[model samples]
Target chain A: MLDQLIYLFRRVFRNIRQSPVLCSAAVGTVAVALTILAFFSLIVINIQSLAAHWSEEIQIVAYLEREPSPARLKQWRDGIEAMPEVAAVRYVNQQEALRRFKSRLGSDSDLLEGFGAEILPASLEISLREQYRNRESAETVVGRLRQNPELAEFNYGQDWLERFEAFLELLRFGAVVLGFFLLFAALFIVANTIKLTLYARRDELEIMALVGATPWFIKVPFLLEGALQGALGAFLALGGSLALFQFFLRQGLVALLSVTGGDQIVFLDWQQQLLLIGTGILLGLVGSVLSLRKFVRI
Target chain B: MIHLYNVCKNYQKDAASALHNLNFKIAKGDFVYITGPSGAGKSTLLKLLYCAEKPSRGQILVNGKNITRMGSSHIPQLRRHTGIVFQDFKLLDNRTLFENVAFPLEVQGKKRFEISNKVYQALKHVGLHGKLQKYPLQLSGGEQQRVAIARALVVDPLILLADEPTGNLDLEVTLEIIELFKKANARGTTVLLATHDQEMIRRFPRRVIALENGQLVNDSAP
Candidate 1:
């Protein structure tokens, strides 16, 4: 068994070395496919991380009725905090809320200030546990908070956040679709390159068949050749991905996205890089084996 | 030894049989020629001998083993005991003459040293020892044929089946290839060559088998 492997390996290496042009073409095809996967993975990671961060920071703000007693306000805060779904609770007094609201109004604060600081009611700022961060889950918590006597009004951008989540879901779905197409393109590219190599050796294949060479005797070298091509392509793709990310990051796309703070837009980390390369190798192997299946008979 | 018991091989639904009730026996060490025109069952007979196709009817036995009933996995094992050559010289263009000849031994899982030595010896037998590093395209038609012969004979197989082995060779090289087959036969190998070259076969009168439209027309010791 060891001897058979040795023979297969030697011939495989020799064939790859003999045709530098064909070998490089196969590798290039694999690398291009791998680069596509890396691009999608990068997008997915960023989208997922950003969504998680936003879910953590979002809170439902419940406003108190005018002239509510301090005892009632304290009781309301305690009740919200005691709920298992509520991770934390803060009471923003009417004056503080009004002051902050004016600052947000920028130059148009004079019209609101004339109405006095008491115009804005106190709000119960509620932060829910991370598990209740989904659109449906967050809405459920809002329903529970609305049944309070002290609360006059409530404001939570549930509609806007739901729309944003839907948009992000669409982006993720698009990325997945794009990813499959890229994988297919990469597979065909690699297979075609390997087919060209096989075509060049068609005569030899016949000779091997006539001489009763086992199917594996003929297939092992091509498969190894494909595997090597995949690995080489992976390396090339890694380089291409790095260069592309650097280019975009240099153009300040990462910083421009900081308005959506906590999204932390960036390229793939080391583990993700490894995954990209691994995927490339798998694609190359499948393409090569599939391409050669018809040509070799055991 | 080999035995064909009323074996008939057909290709398609409408096509006629390539071999019709072919009853024959080839004892060990027989050197015979399957002489026929194109589309006359010559290639099909060789294909069956190497287990490439099963008989549509009847059966065959090689060394008392029923090859027609044997599974696909056993085909390679049967082929290990046989060697084959083709008229177009099925030599791998990407492989060097040495690599091509060394292929059979490698298939046997022989050690590299053993393969190299046997391949060198086979090349020497075919008078291609000096051109081991040359690719098939770089060599002439005769040289390529010689490389194919070396590859077939390298495994020291018991049976050697040739499909129009000299159809494309010149007169001078044709005799050289015939001599190699004769020499291999003298070493106890059963040689069966398919050829339309009557003049060449006539010169080396031995056992001759004729096929016409899939029927065995004649079998006689020339």
Candidate 2:
């Protein structure tokens, strides 16, 4: 068994070395396919992280009907702070609201000079707990807050959050569908590539069959070739992704993504990288097996 | 021993039969020749005996076991004890002569030293030991056939099947190949040589099974 294994390895290496062009074509096709996959994988990973981060930071601002007495303001703050969903609440007085509005007006502050503090409503800025940050949970919390008569209006940019969440869901679904299509496309490409290799050596394989070489003798070497091609392709893809990432970082374009505030896009972690490599190898093996089925009768 | 009872083969459905109702038997260590003109079912007969193509209509027995009923998975096991040399030489163009000859033993999972020693001996027996590293394309027609014979005999198989083993060689090379077959037969290997060269048959006669249009015409002893 060991002898056969050693010979099998020798034959696989020799077969690859004997036809470097065909072997390279197979590897190159796989590399190009996997690079596309890895690129999308990176985008999906970062977008998911960005979405989660933004969701955790969602805030709500509740405008007061009028400037409450100091005791009434304290009571309102205490009431909101006591809610299970409320993480923290900050009280913004009428003066502070007017100051903030003027600062935001910048060059137009002169237009706001005649405006009194009453023009800007005193509000309570509410931060929800992490668990209450999603669309459904935030809506539920807003429903609970609306029961208070002291609040004149509730503004949490809910429409923007809802749109963002919907868009994120669509993007995720699209990524999954696209990922599956790319995988099958890669499988087909690799299968045809391997079929070409099989055709090139059909006569040799026929001779092997004549000489009593088992089906496994013919199969193992080709399977190994597929796996090796997959690994090589994965390496090529990893290199391409890393090069692109470094280029983006060096150009200082990471901030333009607006996902992580200039933070560099993280490459696949060790486990993810391993999984990617394994997936590549599996694709190659499956492709080769499918291509080889028709030829390996004996 | 080998036996064929009413064996028949057709390459395609509704096509002419390649071999028709063939029946024969050869004892152990026998030397036999199957002869006829082109398309005489000479190659088809050898192919059937080696189990490359199934007999579409009857039974074949080797060593008293019904080979016609053998499963596809067990075909390799049957082939390991049987050697076949094709008319085209069938040597792998990409492999060295040594590798081609060593292939059979390697298939059996033989150790490196055993394969090396046995392949060397087989090549030496066929007078091609000095050209072990040469590829098939690099060798002459006679040399390639000799290498193929070495590959076949490397397994020390019980039955050696040759289909036009010397169809491409000149008279001198043909005699050399015949001598190699004679040597293998002397070693207790049953030899089946399929050919159309009557001159060689006249020169070295044995049991001749003649076929014409896929039917057995005559089975004669020299």
Which ranges of candidate 2 are over 4 A from the true structure?
Answer: A67-79, A248-256, A259-261
* Interface RMSD per candidate (angstroms): 2.0, 1.1
Query: What CAPRI-style quality would you assign to candidate 1?
Result: medium
- On the 0 to 100 scale, the lDDT of residue A289 in model 1 is 92
CA RMSD for every model?
Answer: 2.5, 2.3
Model 2 agreement with the true structure over B1-222: per-residue lDDT tens digits: 999999999999999999999999999999999999999999988888788888899999998888889998888988999989888999988789998999889878888899999999999999989988989999899999999999999999999999999999999999999999999999999999999999999999999999999999999998
Query: Per-residue lDDT tens digits of candidate 1, residues A228-247?
Result: 78888998999987787676
Question: Lowest-scoring 10 consecutive residues by lDDT in candidate 2 chain B?
Answer: B44-53
Worst 10 residues of 2 chain A by lDDT: A249-258
Question: Cα deviation of B46 in candidate 2 (Å)?
Answer: 2.1
Per-residue lDDT over A51-109 for candidate 2, one digit per residue giving the tens place of the 0 to 100 score: 78777778888898898899988887898888888899999999999899889989898
Q: How close is candidate 2 to the true structure, as a TM-score?
A: 0.93
Please give the CA lDDT of all the candidate structures: 0.83, 0.88
